[model samples]
Target: MKTLFSLFIALLFSMVAMAKDTDTRYYEMRIYYCHPGKLPDLLTRFRNHTTKIFERHGMTNVGYWVPVDNKDNALYYVLSYPSKEARDASWKAFGSDPEWKTVATESEKNGKIVAKVVSVFMNLTDFSPAVKAQAKNPERVFELRTYTAAPDKLNDLLSRFRNHTFKLFKKHGMTNVAYWTTIEKDGAQPKLVYILAHKSEEAGKASFEAFRKDMKWVKARDESEKNGKLTEKVESMYMTPTDFSTIK
Candidate 1:
């Protein structure tokens, strides 16, 4: 009886050690811009084979999307891995897999599908909600935004969002999806990226307008800017989730 009890305790410790915190997970945001008329090929490949192959190699498919307007020649998707090292290993295995090699060769028989690929690895911030699929209540439109921090003000910007901005956004009818900081490497400035869900494009605009004018928001913004500006530039893109996207 004593030995059995000791073994149970050791097993519990092993289980605890194996459980990884969600914050330690590494996520990849990849955008693939297709050749002139090859977007269909790329989409078909991902839908039929690529996503499954990624899973076989231990990568998590978060969501996929495309722009809602013209020049919709790009695919945006995110994948999660246990860690940065795990991500590298999975990609290496995926690239060399026999099935993937065959699929890539057959798919490009028409022509090279993708013209450019942009990939950034990121980690979710401390105060951000966990990344998961949300129900499509009334079919929300998602806005992807990126901010380039001014000088040394990234932490200040993150703090403001953690404490005030996201809350006001919710109060005005915007759902904060996820927030992340791009893992800087080789002298890259780590950018802040996030997504907000809205009922519609017009609704998102109205919510932002109201949020900006609210007295509490105005005071918070003024106080944060006393030292200096938080960000030098902000970029935004509105997107609708692809039919296969788990988030939808």
Candidate 2:
């Protein structure tokens, strides 16, 4: 009996240690540009000054996007980190880099490139199965999805999502790793898009199975169908994180 109890205790300790090591923090940076036309300029600055600088110091760039809907006026991007400490330290160093300073100054020389920008932070919810289930196996199989809503349908679309679809997602194990919306800074149209970190392409594909069966999802679908369509339509794209990119 004594030996069996000791073995059980040791197993429990091993499980606890493993759980602690799997804690990952994903950062979703939603950068809404004020001027859509200045996007080219902003991208150049991002590549040279911001993203490149972070990569030099070690930050992972996970995904990036610009709205395909004509109603959207801003751009969006995402990054992830092993922990918030890594994020803060790497950004601190990158922010203080002399080369980055030079790039920033030069980037702005042409004009006031960005009129305004807003950022929000979010954590993967505890109930997220992708985040929780993937803890046991750290395999690279996740993809990010972004949905851009039409200008007029933005509020209604988000309402249906928050009130209806989100619960369905949880039920189906469509683990939402991070989520947020964009705020108007300059020329940006009001819009919302969210990113989900799937474990594998197959897992991501299979999520629709549960989603399709969930009664709540069906109800939500019916309600949207009744609303004569809340979104202007949706644009979706699949992406994988660049190895060693700063947005990760």
Candidate 3:
């Protein structure tokens, strides 16, 4: 009996350790729309100074990219934090850093570099692979997909991805970078956003073709929508890493 109790205690401790290791981390996805002809200045700031300042405040610079197919001058990047509290604290510190203030002041001496900024705070889904699990292929293309769920069907959409869609994606050779749902106050509630990596644009096309034809995925998607469609619309964009990006 004593031996059995010892084994139970050991198992409990093991579970606790695993839970701690897998603690949820928060992510911030920021999109910057550059002022006319100012994209270079914005990129220079991030490459030479902003990224280092972010690190000083405990923010993990995940990756930075510019859309391959976007006509507008836009930049997208991801940052990781241990928790929402940590994210808030770090941003507060980063905003107040004298160096950052100096950089911003000097960089925009002529005019503002950015015309608009959009930020979304996200929490990773339960099944998302770690950020470090990204593929090492330098030419890999990252596809960011944003889905707007039908009213009241957000949970249903998340369930389908959690249980069926992600597995099928992996089976078709797609690398799941990260999955996230925006925090409510960010304004786009009932939305699912995720990034996938592919060897190339042609590979991405082929993978999605196979993924859509997968019988399991078809059945799962159909069944989930019997009551009503899960997603109303999906927006997708292909992005390539900037030369100075941390992840590529």
**Top candidate, metric lDDT:** 1
1-248: candidate 3 lDDT, tens digit per residue: 99999999999999998787673888889999998899999999999999999999999998898998867899999999999889999999999999999999999999999999999888877777777624387798889999999988888899999899998999999988888887866455547989998998889999999999989988998999899898889998999988778778
TM-score result, candidate 3: 0.90
Tell me the whole-model lDDT of each prediction, alpha carbons only. Answer: 0.89, 0.60, 0.89
* Error of model 1, residue 86, in angstroms: 0.8
lDDT of 3 at 142: 89
Regions of model 3 farther than 4 Å from truth: 1-7, 133-135, 186-189
> Model 3 clash pairs?
none
Clashing pairs in 1: none
* Per-candidate TM-score against the hidden true structure: 0.89, 0.52, 0.90
Lowest-lDDT window of 10 residues in candidate 2?
Answer: 128-137
- Tens digits of per-residue lDDT, candidate 2, 1-248, equal 99999999999999998688553574547566646467667766666567766667876564555543424345566666666688788879987999988887887786776766766554443333332212323343334444556556666776787777777776676656555454345755545555554566577668867788878788887887674666664545444433323333
lDDT, model 3, position 247: 74
lDDT of 3: 0.89
Query: What TM-score would candidate 2 get against the native?
Result: 0.52
Worst 10 residues of 1 by lDDT: 15-24
